[model samples]
Target: MPKKAKAHASRQITLSELVTIQAGYPFRGSIQENPDGDVKAVQPRDISDLGELSADKLITTNLTGKRKADWLQQGDILFISKGIRHFACYVPEDMPETTLAPSLFLLRVKPEYQGQLNPEFLTWQINQAPVQRYFDNSAEGSRQLNIRKPILAAAPIAVPDIETQNTIARLYAASLRENALLHRLIHNRQQQLNAIANDLISHS
Candidate 1:
């Protein structure tokens, strides 16, 4: 008989165990058209497919001091709870003070487990294809799939050693930077093509 490969030892934990998941604030009333409003609220539309936040699309809100806790902080991971497409984005330290819309979930690592789990790693893992498929399968709603808090909490995660987690997170960040550069190159080339086409049309 052939020898079977042994599975690597790893700690498996439910997402809920590693982090505290909270639903985003449900902002009432219309968004302020003024860019200088008190708060910048992040909506589902502001999340890109690559789990990047589009700063230009964020809408301003009029939230007061009483709702200060509702504001997202650096290292906070925002997960799209409801929608056909899901995204998980890490809030950068340089991001302006912002609030989350109702359709998103804010995931923060438990204080005790912060050293064990990397925030960027968790975000990247949740956006992985397997995890995304899990969300798609568990989501509810007839018209549009909606991932509830419980569903997200129940998702499984592999907790590897801290060193491995850090390595993977660094690689993931590098990949994101590479992709962004590629996107910019493509966009610039397309603009050049458009300009050439316009010039040729004028000459003709």
Candidate 2:
């Protein structure tokens, strides 16, 4: 753990104790692009490397009563359990009624532990380099690495006071927003340069 993380560690608890972690429902049918479908499904690709959701790739489907428990809610976190790189995405309040794909693990803070653990903080913590490394090491499979439920359940998380957790989560969110703006700015600049180059070439 880094010095800053160590300083924040007022107490330690297994991830499972703080949040209920369960694998997503396995949808036997294909993920169709039905905007009018009853339910939206969040696939692994829908989560970006920065832990933000990309709605462009989200697919809609009809979920049955048995899978209602998989419905995502605000403050819920989705973990990419299978893949070369793992990502943790925090669900936002404005997201439509959505459910996770089979490749993800739904992380919901236990009601009793909700006051003690902030969902944003837990999601940010899991995305941290140290915790990511732990997941990387625990991941199984030669071609496609997959994190098992037991490994995630046993992983330790540092829990600071509620105030500190909120502050950290706020800072993390600000950084992500800043990063997104920077990316857009860079893309615009690149497009302008490409357009100018093409105009100059045409004139020459």
Candidate 3:
């Protein structure tokens, strides 16, 4: 309807067409945390509601299996497969030697589509209202909803031109930073107010 809305490329494609999706490392039993562990483990809690991954909070664990670990790479997308919030997060370039828990699905752009598709754009698209609605509707389970790989692979993504995608992704990232700053400011102001009130009460 709007001019800007029509600006995006009309080529709507399924997610599977552009990327290879793989479930995260299938570590048996609970991951044992080690103070001097070799690798960082990304759990669902490590991802923020705004779709940003908090790398610092990731627990370090000594990976134990004989199988080679599928280490997370730059430009990979992490999708929360099981949870009430099925959002996708972009892995930044400066990530630690990390592997995620099985609760996430790792998406890497296929070799052919590498330059054509931007990982940040894909993450933003998957977390968009329309795509999230698709996941919400398709998710199974009464208490804790789980998004199947098929449902995620079949999710429709509007593939705009590279320029548009990059612009959108950058803007989304900037917005997330602004949101975080605002929340921090609010929290600090609340703390200041509490301190002032406590001081006044003590003096009274």
- Candidate with maximal lDDT: 3
lDDT per residue, candidate 2, 124-176, as tens digits? 99999889989988999998999999998988889899999999899989988
Each candidate's number of clashing pairs is: 0, 0, 0
In candidate 3, stretches whose alpha carbon ends up further than 4 angstroms from where it belongs are 1-6, 94-96
For the record, the alpha-carbon RMSD of candidate 3 to the native fold, in angstroms, is 2.0
Best first by lDDT, ranked:
3, 2, 1
Q: Which residue pairs clash in candidate 2?
A: none
Best by TM-score: 3
Candidate 3 shows a clash count of 0
TM-scores, all models, native as reference: 0.89, 0.90, 0.93
lDDT, candidate 3, 114-198, per-residue tens: 7889899899999999999998889999989999999999999998889998998899999999999999999999999999999
**For model 1, how does the per-residue alpha-carbon lDDT over 8-100 read when each residue is reduced to its tens digit?**
467878999999998877556544556667778888888888888787778776764345546677788999988788789988764556778
**lDDT against the true structure, each candidate:** 0.83, 0.85, 0.89
Which segments of candidate 1 are over 4 A away from where they belong? 1-8, 29-32, 64-69, 94-96
Clashing pairs in 1: none
User: Against the true structure, what is every candidate's RMSD?
Assistant: 3.1, 3.2, 2.0
Is 1 or 3 the stronger prediction by lDDT? 3
